[model samples]
Target: MTLPAPLTGVVPPVCTPLTPEGEVDVPSLLGLVDHLVTGGVDALFVLGSSSEAAHLTDSQRRLVVRTVVAHVAGRLPVLAGAIDMTTPRVLDHVAYVVEAGADAVVVTAPFYTRTHPAEIARHYRLVAGRSPVPVIAYDIPVSVHTKLSAELVLELAADGTLAGLKDSSGDLAGFRAVVTGARARAGITGFSALTGSELVVDSALALGADGAVPGLANVDPEGYVRLDRLCRAGDWDAARAEQERLCALYGMTGVGDRARMGASSSGLGAFKAALYLRGVIACPATAQPQVPLSEGEVERVGKHLAAAGLL
Candidate 1:
């Protein structure tokens, strides 16, 4: 099936909300969605890295997807992140979500176990073949340590199975290669690329990317909007400045390790806590095992947000 017009605009990898007792906080989840919508993001990505997809059970993942799909009320495209290391499991999850009415699926390369490039290509092709909707290739080697070569991606794009790709790899050469090659190929009209990292939003856009699927958009959705506007308006200087500002918020969350704190998995706990403190999300509680920030960390984050005018 043909994919939707290359998805443009900011798509935030939304965080999963949890109760004080560590249950999936449906109310808070709904509240966060409303907050993001009000913050002006173009779409919502549930169960992505920022959403802590890795830590959630299959049932929880389905519930989050169904809940967000319902809560969104079709206001925007809700793409579910089906990131599994195995094809059978990923395809099953993909079918489940497509039946749940997800707009698209972001399938990353198999990483739990090593696989060759030919195997990787076949895996995605099979996934796209099974998926009811379009498939978005997710390339975040930092988390999985497995790279989906641009050449393989070009092959998928040529065949029309892979609808789009998200380059979280942070390798400029790789990104440019895929972009240029895809642009030159046939039946790749719907293929799009997104920068998983916020720092490269401007640069990625310059390289013909659709937009970004950034973690920072959880806290600063409007900032992403501003960056997109600046870039599209040809003001790279302003866009770069906004990118730096967003990175500052990321710094408060503690860079790489901070994103994996406690049972939170992807810093969603800290992000929610900061939002709760700012009165954005009513419940600051995270899933069990996800330790909320220490008093000092919260204080420092508060100072940072205030300094950045987020508070």
Candidate 2:
């Protein structure tokens, strides 16, 4: 199917559930999808950073896209994250997502290389030019160590092939530039600018962002739903308060620690622990990506939830 319009509002980057045997736990994943939808999310973002896409195999990634599409069943748009360091690989993954009936694809510019602004434009152009579905440019400076500059994004915007953007860089300057560029395009349905930063959800919204795709939404669905409602109703003060609460809730997950694993198995382990502590999903999704969280860390997560009134 062709993609739906550029997405808005909260799109939870779902966690991939794995059995104790380290297999993709289809049942658990489906259950989480249902919970998130019922919890009032506007869309689903699968195979994203929070979903541990790097740890999943090619076959598993395809399965995830398929499972989420089936679970959503057209109730909401499903944007599959295309996590690859190479252009060809990302294109191939985008093809798979479209064939599996995803609504759009989220791709960060080529990582591991110091990509130039022109190369960034070409990368997004090539993906959007070749893909059967719409594309959402994902710019997460922390994970990829590469940024999709607004100037480059605007250059691609002229092509009308780019679907929109998911700005995970968390920099207000970067966010402002993208929104400003997108706003100038008359034909474009306002290029989607999604904030990955929970701390800036309201500010981003106030600054003309379409919405957000926060990792914190996984732990505090009720809070995010409230925030979304408040923002939509133009209650910036209330929304900002709720966004701060979400940032506090996400602080429990040890966000800074995941970067230390440096492509090891331990990275995925800590994420699963956060979800477990929040009672969003059970533990042992996969031991291959990272080692299990220590007892102290796990207990700390519990205290975090209790302190935040999440438990």
Candidate 3:
């Protein structure tokens, strides 16, 4: 299917469900897909940061893409995150997921190596040139240790090397620049500017972003969809109310004790815990080496769910 020009609306970066044994739980993964699809998400993004793609084995990552693609069955676009340290490693992942049926591939700037702007541009241009499906740049500076500048992103979009961008940099001003630039560029069509900011979906859309790829959407897909529709319908007040409500719900990500674990543990662990509490997934187990939330933290997640009416 042709990716929507400026792919818009809610696209949840799916959380990878794992069994107690640390293996990909296919049943739970499929169940999660059903939940998102039924919850009115516009698309599915598998193998993303939320999916623990960095921790997953190559085989497990391929399974995730293939399973999500097969289950989605063209119902919505399935974009897989082909995350790796550099271009060559990332290209291997790109080939695997694309062959497995991902509608598009999400790549990040090269990490580990001292990368130049020239190297970053060369990396994306090479990937996009070789990819069979559309290429969407995943600009998540926190993970990659490199930020995708508005100048570089707009240049790539104008050149047709990037079909879209998933901005997780949390720099709203920079995000706004890319959003405005995407619109202002004369011949750029279908270049989506998607925000990974869950707490500011309404703000991003209001600033003229094409859509949001909020990870919190997995916990509350309907909320973001409502926010998106509210923004589109020009119901700014209601959208702000809904967005603030979600921002409150997002507080659960911090409920996990910081000193006990890292942000990924606290945040993603909270999300998985919320999913398990909500009955959307059978297991809340994250990949190994990541700290698990304590029972008290799990209880806190339930309170957030109740407060949000998710329970």
Candidate 4:
């Protein structure tokens, strides 16, 4: 399906289900897709940070975009992450995913090599010029080590190099600047300003954000969808209550043992384990090199699910 301009509502950054030996588990992956569709997500964002796009082999990333696009059958937009270290590498992944039928591609600022603001602008313009579909700039400073300034984003949006932004920079002030800029900029119609902050969807929407790309929405999409609705409906009190509940449930990410693993292992592992416990996927295994959650951690995930009435 062609993506709607200013894509709105809940778009989950999907998880990549892995086999015990670390290959993509196609069946489980499909199952998780169905779960999200059924749960009422507006769109599916595959090969994103939640999906471990950086860790997946090129072949694996291709398989993921192809499988999801085929199975979805255009029910909704499928956004593939063309995440790589530089513009040339990102362009290669972009070619693969669009060929595989992705509706749009998500990319971050160049990494592994220090870059300048001028270089960043050139990179995105080059990408947008070549891409067959819309390119959403992913502002994930935590991963890329370079925060996309509000001025730079506005300049890009004005010239149409970026169709949208996925702001994971955790700078609401900067996010608000983009949100307001998108509105005031003449002829910049249908510019999606989506937040990657799962913790602040209500606030984001309240401040004119087009939508959210919350990783937590993978486990309870209905909650995020409901939050989106409540925000749109101008029911701020109700939205706040609901967003708080989900935020509380999000505390499950802390269950994984910190000393033994990194944030990815803890956060992604907890989400997969919760899905397995909820009977969505056959297994909770994450890709290799990321430690699996211990039995104790799994139990903690269950408790979070139960507390959220997902168990």
User: Candidate 3 on 7-31: residue-level lDDT in tens?
Assistant: 8999999999999899999998999
Comparing 2 and 3 by lDDT, which wins?
3
Superposing all C-alpha atoms, what RMSD in Å does each candidate have to the true structure?
2.5, 2.6, 0.8, 0.7
lDDT of 4 by residue, 158-237 (tens): 89888899999999999999999889988688899999998999999999999999998889999999999999999999
Give the clash count for each candidate.
2, 3, 0, 0
| lDDT of predicted model 4 | 0.93
Query: Top lDDT: which candidate number?
Result: 4
Worst 10-residue lDDT window for candidate 1 reads: 255-264
Question: Using Cα atoms with residue i matched to residue i, what is each candidate's TM-score against the true structure?
Answer: 0.92, 0.90, 0.99, 0.99
Per residue, candidate 2 scores C-alpha lDDT tens digits across 176-273 of: 98887788866656467788876778888888888788776776667787898899899888888887777776665563255444433343454466
Which residue pairs does candidate 3 place in steric collision? none
lDDT of each: 0.81, 0.77, 0.91, 0.93
lDDT of 1 by residue, 85-108 (tens): 799999889988888889999998
Show where candidate 3 strays beyond 4 Å: none
Error of 3 at 299 (Å): 0.3
